[model samples]
Target chain A: MIRRPANLRRFGLGLLVAMPAALVVWWFLAAPLLVPGMAPAFAWLLQLIWPQWGPAVEVNGNAWLVVTTLPLLEQPLQSAAIPLGPRRFTAAFALFWGLVLATPGDLPLRRRLRQLLAGSVLGILPLVLLMALLAFHFQLAVVINHQPALTVTPPSVHVLALPYPGWQFHLIGVGRQLGVLVLPTLGPVLMWAVLNRRFIRAMIFTGLLSRLPAAAGELDHRDGRA
Target chain B: MSRGLLIGLTVVVLAGCDAAPQDLRRALAMLHNDQGAAAFTQLQDLAATGYAPAQFRLGMLYLQGEVNAERRTLAERWLMRAAAQGDVGARYYRALLWLSRRRDADAVDAGAQALERLAADGFRPATLRLAQAYEAGDGVQPDVAQALSWYEQAAAQGERRAIERLATAYQNGELGLERDAALAQRWRRQLAREPFSLSD
Candidate 1:
């Protein structure tokens, strides 16, 4: 087993060194390239779901410009572009990478790399899904707000037969607040904690680790003979 | 001691989960899910029971989706009820609804008064709206000075739209203000640092 004091020091030092570097790489290179590419996928998904909406995606630097038809109150359907900075969500990847890298060097390089890959998938996929859902919810709000106008003629193209119920809007609103405020910050930490639970216990909860017989046995087994 | 602490924490967490907001959210979710009848059934009861948020939401729903005269009246009634209970959102929406009815001079006057009160109370959206009203002569008389003052108030509150407006006004010497490129640049820089929100 890795010495507790040395492991803690190494992890702390690793975090101090890796965090800024990871953030710099993510912000300057990876996010700019990867974030813009997500727009097309989002556009494809939106179009697939709401064919009549005819969602279009445009890349403007790090932001995705999503242009889609939105029903307006007392007016014909108008095309609106909602610019989403998905880079904000992808920034969590930097934190995830930093945490993964900051893990003590005792873990096998192959396993650490696997953990990093898993963290990336776990961290990013939900954010992507959230962005998509927020976009859809925003568009749905437009439809809901203009339900009366949409029911009338001249705007014969009905995006949805009936607008989503009010409770769904509240749910989306809550989801959005959580996604924006909580998830981006907490998600990476949670992922890191789960992935490095053993390391965490060894470093921070040594007493608890020793007190739990099963945990102690598992650690001993991992250290040598089962 | 640890076990007691854990129990205390659990109790606190449980206590923090207010059922009212959850119920309100569920009703709103029903409304968004196209289950208007069900949402209304829940909301109307809550609103009738003098739940300010429910009343405000019901008002907003009617304002947004209902075009009929009777529904409009109902929207006004619900909004008024909520506003009477000191719901700022309800008050703002009610004022906006009244302002939109420009044909009724009395309603426009009431809206202008309500907006002025809200602006004075340091409500950012209300300040911005009041400024716009003065600038465009929507519900109130076109007063460049009043517009500038309200815009400045909103800008002080870090309202992006107000900042942009002031920046443009200063740059072009609009609203009878002296053109100052330096002031315009400062506002522009502030705007750059201001975080963009979807709502904004």
Candidate 2:
């Protein structure tokens, strides 16, 4: 029972207005608070994965500082710190919200809000977590490879050994590159498509509506005009 | 009209994100999406027509995923062509490919020589790589003095790897250098000032 052409215009205008507003709100309000708040979770995860490193995470503004022990060759444990900006992975949250808010106004407000909550928890959160882990591993590998005194063993069958194998570094490299380049832009679009499949189909396939039982004769008059 | 507008907007966004030519950008997008065969088909004509970026990208594709001797040779040829056109990335990767042939002493020497030239041009990665080669005696002789000098040069240019190496070397008195806590502390401070980024 949705109107064609007019609703599409509304959707476009809504997107144009909402996208930048969402991005601004995210950058100033949400990201600054959320990224810093993520430090504890990341610290716990890193500690679980790499207990030998004795990972300690601290927040400095929006960035997380990870202090860890470096096991150099024939030397006592040396301290090193790596800084990570979670904002890079969290921008998709804004994009997803923008798309959700821009859905056709005819839809129930409560349903839209529900979709927003689901998208945030189900899609964006997992993406941010995965990207952070990949980025952290890649950064640590680079640091380990740079240290001349650290003896890295050759490629081993065990992938997660303390002294990382060469192939693991390569795998981390590819994962990091994909996380940095592709996921930020594509993740939101896919989420929006999944949530708005009905709306999308109605907009794209007006001719096919005549064959459906629900709105068969209802859309027939407009099909020729469309 | 709305559909047309959406398509237009998508094209504008994609084009605005990258400064590369439209076709080359499409090829790169294909490659990113793991459409290797399609990307190869699109890039071949551009690379044949002497587009340096296309040559470089095509060469990189050839090196990807279970590369054999034939693919390596093709990669080298395309990389050399791109390097001749002054693609810095191609030149660096070509040197790396040469260095990977460790059993071939001549190739190793050639790679080391390429790295030295790139370092002289103030490419930070090249400076760091040359220092590592000197330290590990990968292709060059194990000269502690040369390694320290190259590491210093790279560190001065704000290369994080070189800074880390220098900090460790000075702290441990490794690489035949006298232990200097002050220098190590200075390098560590510099390292802390360097921002972390995923890009090389």
Candidate 3:
């Protein structure tokens, strides 16, 4: 109403809300993936079994793979698209937030697309690291529980190697502890951002339509004056 | 004809309908009285017209190998025919045949199609077998949805094993379920009851 532009404020507010929420939900859902009694997780995982998620690493009674986490995003999206109850509400909330936060106002269409992509990448980058750490912990737990007899191999070597130490991680460099945003994977996030933007635009459509009455009233008044 | 002869004949014929009702009651009594051999003979004569219960019972006898050398495939074929004609118990036995061969998906399909007859009143032994099918992945894809469906069915029918399975599914949320602690507790509480449904 006063000074600042409505578009910029709304976009900032939207990003400030949605991106963190997506990460929060990712971490929340990752609890079952990280925890034990994971039959349901594996059962659901079976549905996600693609050769592309990465090669499977069978350890102990469990298995883990280093797939791009974008597949995870798709599962939740497909889940949310036709879900019932509170989960549906959560998806709507996330989509709405993504639109408001990621989009840039007071810019041309091309620049706006650029800003939105950049913002979403900055937001999603941390979560990818979190997911890799989670995978390492889960796989390590599996291997430790199924240690072999100490006859042929030394006990110290195998037990400790099941979980590589921090210095070892620094030296050998496995897992996503370092926040290297996979530039290629951003394509999926951008696709989802586009989808989320469309969803928010859908919700805001009714407000846009509310102006139709005012436009009609002004058109009638102008015709009378003419 | 003489009047005395006519009156006597009329009285005798008039008493037959009353005896028909009494005879059915007696048949149920004889079946319950451990006079299976005699009751079977009577039921067999009555059942020859292809009544479903007679066909089901005779099918059961053949299925169990007690009355003679068990002819399971033949028994299943007859029971399948009886079940198709709406014999409620026949679905239960026929499900067993499909299950024994690890055809759980087919068994479950059979159980659900016949639910209005078999599981309509309550879960029974046959219904519990359907639940086991979902759990063990015998003939169907291992699914929490189907497992939960069968567990709830058998639990309603008073199958203890089904009650246990439902408890596990609820407690673990193993079947794409949201964690509902209250429903899990309720199922646990219901566990300590007498066998109330047809499962007994």
In candidate 3, the residue pairs with backbone N, CA or C atoms under 3 Å apart (3 or more residues apart, or in different chains) clash, namely A14-A101, A15-A101, B104-B139, B105-B139, B105-B140, B123-B157
lDDT tens per residue, model 3, A1-226:
1243455466668678767875576346633343233323332332234211122222232233322211111111000000001121123224433554456544566665665455434543234323433333333322222121111111111111112333543332333222223322443355455545654464366446656677788889999999
After superposition, candidate 1 runs with Cα above 4 Å error = A1-226, B1-17, B197-200
Off by over 4 Å in 2: A1-5, A72-77, A147-163, A207-226, B1-200
Positional deviation of residue A203's Cα in model 1 after best superposition, in angstroms: 20
The worst-scoring run of ten residues by lDDT in candidate 3 chain B lies at B16-25
- What's the DockQ for every one of the candidates? 0.02, 0.02, 0.01
Q: Write the per-residue lDDT of candidate 1 for residues A159-187, one digit (tens) a residue.
A: 21224455765576666667667878887
Question: Which predicted model would earn the best lDDT?
Answer: 2
Docking class of 1: incorrect
DockQ for the candidate 1 complex? 0.02
TM-scores, all candidates, are 0.46, 0.46, 0.33
Per candidate, the number of residue pairs that clash is 19, 0, 6
* lDDT, model 3, position B172: 80
Q: What's the CA error at residue A176 for candidate 2, in Å?
A: 0.6
How do the residues A90-203 of candidate 2 rate in per-residue lDDT, one tens digit apiece? Answer: 999999999889878576888888999899889887887777877777767666544211232211111111224557767877877777778887988898889899878877
RMSD, every candidate, angstroms: 15.3, 20.4, 28.4
